[model samples]
Target: MLKLSEIQRPIERELTIFEDKFKESMRSSVPLLDRITHYIVKRKGKQMRPMFVFFSAGSCGEINDATHRGAALVELLHTATLVHDDVVDNANVRRGFFSVNALWKNKVAVLVGDFLLAKGMQLSLANDDFGMLKIVSDAVQQIIEGELLQLEKARRMDIDESIYFEVIRQKTASLIASCCACGAASTGADDATVEQMRQFGEKVGMAFQIKDDLFDFGIDDVGKPLGNDIKEKKLTLPLIHALKQVGKPEKQRIINLVKNHNDDSQKVTEVIAFVKANGGMEYASSQMLAYQQEAFNILTHLPDNAYRHGLEQLVRYTTERNK
Candidate 1:
């Protein structure tokens, strides 16, 4: 495994460029919008999608100015989505600061999100690469659809494993797939190489999300509220799996918690304890390892390069970071 510092160095450098482009795209003398966007810009994130695009593109072909621009575009789109997500969730804090919605209210946040999305589209169109435009458009469409799909799945207490996977694929894996595709889109990588990158991204996305669910069950200071998914009455894969394994009484009890919207402060703790006692958390963690391994396996087929090593290190870092 590569050191986290080594894997993050290139990503961090690119993030500076991403922020500059992002701020430039959001250009406005209006204090509110500027303050909002600036607050969001300075609040750092992992930049996984952009790094995925950059590394994959460079490994398969020459990394150039266009590739960097494409990477910036992905980050912009992702940030826009987060702004919108905060509104949708009515969230108070993100990345340890006041959310746009929390600071400025829903309308402002919504409009800012719209502006960000429009700017992202504008940047992608500037490239005159219709292929990339279509790719990003498709990704945006999938992201919206996935959000609605997850919302639709929220009340479903009996959401099956297949349904859970479908939600994961749409809500998380699609963007990751798009990131890898954007990389290949910028390069001479053949269809096989692009497909491999997509596969890797899919597995990585799955691993990333599964670990997130496990973190909800394990970590105390994720910054976001613990088990917000469950509180919102949306049972994730681990919970769904544990529900299936339990007897009727426990299942009904869990269902009642959902039905009542779970008033108790210890609800998450109790749910987590139930999951651990029944092996749901361990099952989720094991599955995360499986997907991470799958991502690493895809790397073996590509010829050795620093980018490839960086990618492997990134894959390892995902699991280790959560651990």
Candidate 2:
């Protein structure tokens, strides 16, 4: 696994430049826009996307200006989407703070989100490279499509497990996969190496997302309120596995809890009991490990180097990360 300290230098430097653009946005003439944008930029996150961009680029050659630029671009794109997402989800809180929409009102939040999206587009185009223009543009479009698909399937109590996974592939994995692939692209890595990094990113992304779902069922590494998926009528993997194995009466009981989303903790507790009795948590945990191992196995095939080691650390962090 790559030491977090080893990568912290570049990641930290990248964040500095990221905050600059964000600050520049704040200096815009619109007072309401600046206020809402500041709310969204507060407490910047782990900067995972930009890190992937640099790390994957390093696999091909020395990290340089293009690397830093790519990192800043993708991370800003990610942050912008996050701001908009909070608005759409009606999510009052994010990153342990009031969401932009909640803090400054949805109108201001939406405008700030649009500003970020425009910046994301400008950031990539500023590269003055056509190939990246195509790649980043397509990724941006795919992100929207993925969100739309997820909204269509939202709150589906019995969403097909296969379909569920596909949704994750589209909604979550695509951006991460693009990070690695784009990193390789920026450095002109050979197709074979680029594809390997792409696949590696994809496997890790899926594993990470599945682990996130498992956390929703019981695990609390991310502090996302355990079992809230069940409470939200979202049929994540753990519950799906239990449903496949449990009796009709029990499944009916679980369904009732979801339908009664506003019910007390007793309602959530009842469904939690049913999941535990059927080994749902165990099932989800095992499945999560399977994906994690699959991610590591992909690492085994990559050329041995610090970059490969960095990727390995990401795999470890996928399941180990805590809020």
Q: Lowest-lDDT window of 10 residues in candidate 2?
A: 217-226
- The all-Cα superposition gives candidate 2 an RMSD in Å to the true structure of 3.1
On a 0 to 1 TM-score scale, where does candidate 2 land against the true structure? 0.87
141-210 in candidate 2: lDDT tens per residue? 7778877766667545557678677777766777787788778777877778777777777777787788
lDDT of each: 0.77, 0.70
Clashes of 1: 0
What TM-score would each prediction reach against the true structure?
0.91, 0.87
Q: For each predicted model, how many residue pairs clash, with residues at least 3 apart or on different chains?
A: 0, 0
* Candidate 2 displacement at residue 53 in angstroms: 1.4
Highest TM-score, which number?
Answer: 1
Error of 1 at 118 (Å): 0.9
**How far does residue 228 in candidate 1 sit from its true spot (Å)?**
2.9
